[model samples]
Target: MNNKRRVTVILAMAAIAPLTFTACAGGGAAPASGGDVKSLTVLDSYNNDPDKGILQASIDKCAAKVGVTIERTTVPGKDRMQTVLQRSSSKTLPDVLMLDNPEVKDVAATGALSPLSDYKVDMSAFAGNSLDAVTQDGQVYGLPLPADTLGLFYNADVLAAAGITPPKTWDELKAAAAKLTTGDQYGLAFSAAATYEGAWQFLPFMWTNGGDETKLDSPEVKGALQLYVDLVQSGSASKSVINWNQADVKDQFVAGKAAMMINGPWQIPALAKVPGVKWNTVQIPVNKPGQTPTAPLGGMVWTVPRTGDKAKQAKAAEFVACTGTEDSQMALGKARNTVPTQNGLHQKYVSEVPTMAAFTKQVEDARSRTGKLGKDWPKAATTIYTAVQLALTGGASVDEAFSKAAAG
Candidate 1:
């Protein structure tokens, strides 16, 4: 699997704290006229095969359309922001930059990125939350590409043999999980590690239960935490969850130790390699019938940096726009196992890739983690995971977990 596509929330949030940059004042390359541009520099975190190649194809297609060669740089996801900061200070920022959506606001706040609006980039086809991911202070900072969200991945064979259907509500989930549990196998598996990955895994349950991140100690949030506690206490979920990451959870599922897991489409390639698994996905269940399952949107956004070259910036903007087009989105979505961020393409995308139907549906109501709290999102994420840890480990009761974690 490509590590770049699986960046944890902690690394992303940590990189933002020291990203102060002076947009156009850096002393490196002189401004070049629009006519002088013949090639554009691009930087992104798709540094492995498959994803690297998949993204390159899209970049190449866009490069051809814009009539310019692309000078690209691929970094590991965790190093992406640091690279940007280093390049920005040295006035060598790439003309086109790809940012993990959650990091967009912090980077934009530093004046390191050019507003796509200034180039008249058409963003009408994108999802509202996708746009919100890159929007800061009324200005659109970047264009989002294909996105992903959490889903309930089940071993079809296990569920069928157990006479179970995919769960749709909290009560159903608990019942199904308990019924599926057997000797040395957990009915449900999810990450509860003390990291942003854990917080992300918890979001669907929290948000669907009407829990707000800003008010962590509220009844709604406690209800969500209690669900986690109940599962572990009942042995429906393993106590090891508090130590496992998403990748670990997937491994457990693949080994048949877990019947279902909370994960994303990025795992599709890995799952495909294990033909014996026979897995399928569904939207994460809501707390009740009327509530919506709101998972956090996961993907990167392309931006034009203030590289002090009008021609290169214009060409880069064109390339960025090209990548977000319906055709480009469809191509990337199919090759990358991601859902297109463009509106009106979900059904069409689903028609083409049936396995992605559930995820596509989830993206419709999914939100950006930074949408509500922006830079402060990391703090909330930390609180969430801490509460989960406390409750699951018996350090605190469900009713006191969030409040205690918040207080600390």
Candidate 2:
């Protein structure tokens, strides 16, 4: 999440970028013998509580079902990839690893991960976009336990007071935002920092406007950039957005400094705790009346690293498989306030958690950040966020932001 670690991951990943899946003969090494081989070393970024407990509970349940003990190492998200790379080079990678969806393909391309299919991990139940994030060259490498995307979160009371409904189109959004701007509270809040979080937040606008990641300097992208710039320049949004992350944006909304924000379902649990802060969500507004919003799919997927020992790998795969079962996915998604990645469970999940209906619909047509460019997506993500920072901070005009940022 920090710039240093992000750049480190980008550089470290290139060291093992070979695209191969040839399993080592005789499975390299074995764990312990017989009954001794009942535990597995796992790595993940569930360092924060409630989420950490939820993930561990599911993992504990799965480990029991699979007849194994889990020895999990919780790391901060910014350090997980660094730890993975260090352990990888030492041939001591964890038996099971949790990776951000985009990083799944990057690590897989390095041939440092085992194919889930090799261990009979059923891949049929996952959503198409969620599955695509972990697949490369026809090999399925990981299973996404939950999938998420951004939507418009609005304060119901504020909207009612302003006599404004949630916007349905870009023009409506701009008008509503302008009308909502009042004393000490801006109409909207969103991240536009020079980080991947910023790029993640911008996807709906960029994609819904017919922008392409492959063409970063296109008119559509500039138009999307202009939307954010206009909001900030008009004082409908704060200039501090150039430094805010999604968390900060949420905080602004909770404090009533912003009436609307673009965020994902994962924040629901926290939002619920703020007494009487009634809120509701809608799909991200489209650029035009006929256009559909397409947001970037987001989640951390479970993977089995190439730990050499076939037996451990198999057990790890079973553990990974267990985490993705419909029951586990639903339980974890509910506890963590996220959407299940299994397509068949969408209706059931929404029925049980009606607040997530908007997100479920968005996830149905969501796009993977790495789907088009695979491992090369990081570079494009950097370009996107840099352009966003520049445009939002007045460092460059919307028409020049992409070209200038791309040149850098």
Candidate 3:
């Protein structure tokens, strides 16, 4: 699975040698003359199987269409930035690079990426948040292939047996979860681990309650944290959430130990394997009746690196463009279990896969994790998850957790 990174570009310039390129065309590196470049080298973090194979199929299709062979390198998700930095310093950066959306701003800030507009890549189809994820200082550095966001995944059989509809508000969710609790199964499952994954899970609750990442110690934010603390304290959620990641939450749900879980579409493939475990998805519940369910956008984007060869870079851009087309998006989405980022294609996608309707609706209200904070987001995300872990583990009260975490 491709885990998203909340990027913080605190690297020294000496570590990743600065590209001495002039920003001649709309803040993008002008493609230099390197005649008849016949092949493209690419870098990405889709080393895991199924995703690796699935992504390569799209690359192969685009490479064949562009009449060029592709030389690709795959790295582990957590190591992708380090790989890029090392490659940048050595001047061995690939012709095309794939970056988690938040990482795009950090990399683009270093002038190592060429703006897609320079190659005339289509910019018409992306949604506002999708476009926002890959843009920095008014220049688009990358194009998202698609987007994913958190949702409430529940056991349809469990909810039906309990005579409960999917929750629409926090109060109802609490009641439903309490009602569903029995034996080893908890009312709900979620990840509150001290990592980016935990922060990703918390965003919907915090943002829906009007909590701003910039104001980490505010009452709105503390109230959201209280909800998690309450869940665990009331035995509706396991105290083990302080250590579980999204995958673990999904496991609990599939094993009949959790009636509901907070996760994203990426879990669809795994959930589908167990035919007996009937499941359905709904938008994450709101804190109150009229509030929208806001979630953090998840996924990576394709970018063209400043390889000092305009011809190869432009051709690479064409391949990047190919990957974002509606057909290409849907193909990869179905194969990898993600939602399309294009505004118009979302309806088409949901109509074809009815299970994704709630996810598609939630994406409209979703914001990029780094949208407001930019490269500094990783710092804030770390604090957010630290507080989540602190509160859930009873290491500190909700207010104390946020205050102490933010203090550091």
Candidate 4:
């Protein structure tokens, strides 16, 4: 699934009424000893094809390696978290669970997940940022698979035709976007919806400019916000961005309404189908030459939940570990169009999928949305998108937008 779907699922899950837990319930029951585990229950939200099929192949391989039969339950992304919460309350949590990276903390905080350390799952191969998302109180709760992050996807044909090059800095982006804008087409397109997806899209610009989520109303943030304001005001980007999700932005890019777009690798499959468009991706531009483009990390993590059955839990951990192995990572990454979380695989992965070079580089330094704020990230994400909407729609000036949104 795309990060937009991941964000929407998280936000939807957050809206549900909070559930309280007793020490025994929250901390998970003591593991029962001595039982043969034949089948393990697994739950995740890969309900669509390609993702669904690709994930199933991995699961089947892992299950065979772990000597267990899998009873997997797939739900729509929007409903997975809610289902997890419901199951948690009823003491029927799946033996294995898959959570979006950011949601790991919230679920782990509730003691619904077991630390991977408990099973001595080896994590040395995974990327630090990917591990950071699933770590709570210094304990890792899950294993991340190949991940995705945002990038600047441009129509190479469009850029060549306009005598333009892919932008490398914010100033150049603004100029290129303006130069590309003409009748019925904008120079650039991006999601600025009043949702976490918008907050996510803005992160590269915000972080590259030295803005922090904890301090959203500062000069650095203002500069980032002003880029959005300027794009809309100068007619280089659609005013309709405030209503567009990432999918809508991709549609705009695919339909020739946008010369370039800010999106992620999850859109690759659909873009591949449109063979006529000569598209390519680059890391989102930095504000200045020295700044590193820091995009938000995107992907789900496979976690072993606190199911109270030691045998099942042990088998589940083995399964999760198998999924993180080098062979599994490469296979899944290739099949799903994502980057492997394993370290030292960059050169090999890039050599295999040349078009993913920019994204591979981006994920190397990508930051997790919940890395600093943990469960409180949803609130900060809300503040960000609210600010974007206000600034882009003239509800407030760029300088005033974050402050006003924070106040509400």
**Which lDDT tens digits does candidate 4 get at residues 61-137?**
98999899999999999898899999998888999999999999999999999999999999998889999899999
lDDT string for model 1 (1-408, tens) is 467755765677667745655454556546555676788888999999889999999999999998999899999998998999999897889999999999999999999999998899988888898988899999999998899899999999999999999999999999999999999889999999999999999998998899888888889889999899999999999999999999999999999999999999999998999999999999999887899889989998999999887778888898998998889999999999899998799889999999999999898889889998988998999999999999999999998888888887
* lDDT (Cα, tens digit) per residue for candidate 2, span 69-133: 88989999999889989988878889899999999888999999989999988888887889888
Report backbone clashes per prediction: 0, 0, 0, 0
Cα error, residue 267 of model 1, in Å, equals: 0.2
Relative to the unseen true structure, what is the C-alpha lDDT of residue 257 in candidate 4, on a scale of 0 to 100?
97
Clashing residue pairs in candidate 2 (N, C-alpha, C atoms within 3 angstroms): none
Q: lDDT scores for all predictions?
A: 0.91, 0.89, 0.88, 0.92
List where candidate 4 sits over 4 angstroms from the true fold.
1-33
Best by lDDT: 4
- The residue ranges of model 1 lying beyond 4 angstroms of the native Cα positions read 1-34
For model 1 the local lDDT of residue 257 reads 96
Please say which candidate is ahead in lDDT: 2 or 3. Answer: 2
Candidate with better lDDT, 1 vs 3: 1
Cα misplacement distance, residue 324 of candidate 2 (Å): 1.8
**Candidate 1 vs candidate 4: which has greater lDDT?**
4
Q: Once model 1 is optimally superposed onto the true structure by TM-score, how far is the C-alpha of residue 93 displaced, in angstroms?
A: 1.3
lDDT of 3 by residue, 1-408 (tens): 233322223344444554433333234444456787678998999998878999999889888878889999999999999999998886778989999998999899899999998988888888889988788888888989777899999999999999999998999889988988899999999999888999989999999999999999899899899889888899999989989999999999999999999999988878989999999999999887788999999998999998777788888998888888887899887777678888888778888888889998898789898788888999999999999988888788887998788777
Which pairs clash inside model 4?
none
Better of 1 and 2 by TM-score: 1
Using lDDT, rank the candidates from best to worst.
4, 1, 2, 3
TM-score of decoy 3: 0.90
Residue-level lDDT for 273 in candidate 1: 92
